[model samples]
Target: MISRLITILQESELLLSDQEIESFSEVQPLLNDEDIADALWLASKIGSAYKVSEPAAIKAVSESDDAIAIEVIDDNTVVVAPSPMVSAYMPPAAKSDNGSMETPELGLPIQVQAAPALAHPREISRSLRPLLRKVPSLTRSELDESATVNRIAERGIWLPILKPSPERWFDLELVIEASKFSFIWQETLDEFQQLLEGQGAFRNVRTWTVKEAATGQPQLVAKRQQGTGIEQDQPLRSPKELVDASGRRLVLFLSDCRSRLWQQGQIHDWLTLWSQHGPAAIVQLLPERLWSQSELDVGFAVQVGSLMPGAPNSKLQIRELPARTEIAPADTLTVPLVTLTAEALKQWALVVAAAGRQRSPARLFDLSWVSDPERDQAMAVIQPQSAKERVELFMATASLLAQRLACMMAAVPVELPVVHLIQQELLPEVQSVHIAEVYTSSLLEEVRPNRGRL
Candidate 1:
């Protein structure tokens, strides 16, 4: 019976390798009914597995001069199978739910368990199956197959920064981590130099000048040495000489500690100082973060000269003073230099308002819609009139569009009409309609000409 089975396998061109056949011969005496059934099952499985790998195997085996074919009959007769002049091709089998074939038991006087291994059938099929029959030895391509499968299953590449291009008229400086002073110092100096060099009313402007503000006899020749920088010194020459050398501008002096303290009340005192003592058209460029802090109290000092009745001399007195204006910083601070244009400011304000609206429960729709189409559709449904309301509507529509797009891209089935309804028809109508009552009414009529269609 064993020889008949072996001959049948060989005739069908489902023969095992020489080594496998030898191993089977040694174990043939241990076979039982269950072992026979398992062997038959394995043969059937090998047939199915070959379908996937047959093309490669055939190409390999057909190249060998020793390749042979065999056939089997239902009556258990064995015969030589025919070989095609050119290799024949077969389509891979459709995947099936049948578990992998179990190995036959050695025909020893031992109890056998019929249960399959704990591993999945697909895994077992891949591990043990051969691609072609009556062709030399079968080689497992498990690793290569697994790698191909994994490559096919992978998703898109994720990057840390998605937006690589900078927006128009906007400059972005990103620093992972650094001290604030070190970061700002070079950038600020460069910007200031550029502005000075550029053609403008303030081009080649000077910030510092020294002149005697008092007149008096040389009662006590008190010499005071000052820092050598342009803005740090007080003039030693006579009042007329000083005026001729520099300009008739009042001087102010503050310690480095005082300057740092004044920065605490940045926006208010800085603006005030510029308005009062500095040039009428001057602007103070300070750190954006420093200007944002609202707690600091600031003070300034102005120098005035008292003329003496006696000789060609003066008494310069430095008087402490208060600021002329004050303002608190908003949550979103806008740098006047970068976003100075009216249109840019307006757009920025809208964006900030939209961001705020997204945080509110009542404005949940704003967070839902992101894409322009969906936002327009949602707006069509819930038409907003005011600028603030429109921003809220756009945000809600954007959120909804994002959610729908994500669902679609993920291959998770979703209702098509719902996606279209929110993104297409509704959002466009809302975005197009003007805010005026008459205009809005006409627009609505034009958008929904067939009221029953929606």
Candidate 2:
């Protein structure tokens, strides 16, 4: 193995960079020189993982990324990589209710669990129907005006400061944990449609033509509503439009909640229809997560003099007041720079909001819906803090989602499952450093109808 791997590495040396060679060398000392063949093979594989110029692909498999695929050859001889698109192996730490475990013959045992893991499927689903009906109805009612005002008043002064206080930090962590259900456990509607198509609930899923604004060429948009017998004279501009169209796929494209559009009469109308005449599924892929901030900001303080044209020494200074008394002088705190512009303030607001979401439980989750034109089918982009938290939320989301879905699908004679993809990142504009898909479930088996007495 050592001789063959060495030969392969020597042949691929031209493709491999010096930095990659160094990375492999760091791992080599832990391996036995006698068993150098396996070490060489591991090193060569890792070296090949790094493309010459492709940063995205490189970042995906890097050691720093939340590596779903990991092999522990030994403590020091661990091999790790990004999770593959599909695998036969059950995710790591996958616990079946029956306490049965299956190990595939080909590879190592995986450590990740799939999403939507539910215990009491029937009772949960039944309870969720009322809220599924109520929230949307309230959003659409004439009382929406008062509801919005009341909601804002109820969530008074939730945003935290740039530097979190001890109490605020504890609150943020709780909120992040609670809101992980929306962020971590999600999937594309198209993927879910595929599962339903197999179950015969959804048939004849087809793509439609929508001309791109930038290029006159047609863009392929999945129009699953085609065979569902819902017709519209004009294209659906919003979810409110879907109500009149009476389509199976009434996707409320709420991309942002902070905007005024979400609070409008259209959202109210859309929600009313959703509650009254339910769709087969209400899969909200994008939950109001920490990463829901419109702007990504990393705050910095620069001296007022640093902004002057031709100022060679452009460095930041933490403005501190001189101590009035000898004892108090040493305890003086650094003041916020006054020179910060409106853009900087806006940036700071996003940072604070993001931080507060991660730190403060006092900050309420924004459940309002906003309009988006890009996505035709459902898609979710999750940003949970950890893999374990993501897995827990995935199951909770499935259980919660199953109940709502049960209400929607109750009208339909056919038993339809609420499928969650859990892995795909629908939004590319989000520049998240650490994120991963924890799991996907069709919810068919997990959310089975009550076999015994209700």
Candidate 3:
């Protein structure tokens, strides 16, 4: 019965077939249905160990019988299924208490229903099983259509393009005029070129051209053209075409030319040379002109009467008057004045020294003394009068120096005001004079011959 069951499974392409049963029966003639069932169950168990279904195990065993099936060489020497196990095969069913259906290898009864057989046999292999289980088969046209849809969805969109700009269209020009003349003119083109090359601010200048003008040429003399947009092969105007219209020789200097020249290479050395030798060189080049102008003299006078002590008893007299030398436009002078009482002068020799030190070309004026008749009377009335009856006399002298400053400058006036002299502790007594006002007048005055002079 097991052999017939195997044949049915093998032929039906289901759980067991007739061909597999016949092949197994041929291998062992004495083997009963129980042993055959056991072998089929072992194959199913191997398939189950690999997570394969019963139908897959059955198909695998039938297709590769040498790896999955038990064989018989002769009746007495039957060959059992190769061990350590061959390939994976189907597992057996368990036995149930009622004995209706059971797979002993799985410890449970088989539950799968068998598939119907067709006239033609369907070949089973490991490669054909998975496709047979899910898709059965696929067409090339359908696979291509699916791939095309996937590619279209994965790609991005296209964008618009921009145009490029044209290469050429505009021109520029610089117009220069050469008619203007500079103070320090360069005589020749070579000289001008050398000057431009020297340095400072004029180093990079290459702009202007110079030429001479004919007598009958138009007043508008020279013109300068800029090279900013000109072609490399374009012809330029000759030096003769550019000229200074005025009859005098003309020289042109472009703005910033001199400054640029001063700033170029070796400028520091050039500047040092100029600083050390330039001024003297210029003085030698240009000498000062002589003056033929005449000179004029002016007169100034100061009053001498202010130096007197009291009211005059006689007319005033003019003694020797001081004379001052004429001064240049830029000079300064100082004058000194001195004053003291007769008793103070007799007590202090410093007072006299001070007067002598301050003396100038000026003269000393003497004033009439106030006479004491009583002192003269005492000298007559008593034989050897006491010193107490002697008269006390006070006198003061002042020395003045006239100073002239600068030929164009006039002398500034100074005033003298009367002031008392005071003595500080341990210090010599000194008289102080204050200046009150100043006036202008002649220094010479006429007076009686016998009058006291100050």
lDDT winner among the candidates?
2
Q: Give per-model TM-scores.
A: 0.16, 0.19, 0.10
- Cα lDDT tens digits, model 2, 70-145, are 5445433546655555555556565468785533234454544433222122332332221121112211324344
- How does residue 291 of candidate 2 score in lDDT? 25
Q: How does candidate 1 score on lDDT?
A: 0.27
Reference-based TM-score, model 2: 0.19
Q: Give the per-residue lDDT of model 1 (tens digit) for 174-236.
A: 111111122212222233333333312120223232222234111111123257522233334
What is candidate 2's local distance difference test score?
A: 0.29
- Of models 1 and 3, which has the larger TM-score? 1
Per-residue lDDT of model 3, residues 247-355, tens digit only:
1111222221122221221222221222222110000000011000000001112112212211111111222344753433122111111111222212111211222
Predictions in order: lDDT: 0.27, 0.29, 0.24
Root-mean-square deviation of Cα positions for candidate 2 versus the true structure, in angstroms: 32.7
Which has the higher lDDT value, candidate number 2 or candidate number 3?
A: 2
**Better structure of 1 and 2 per lDDT:** 2
How much does candidate 3 score in TM-score?
0.10
Clashes counted in candidate 1 amount to 39
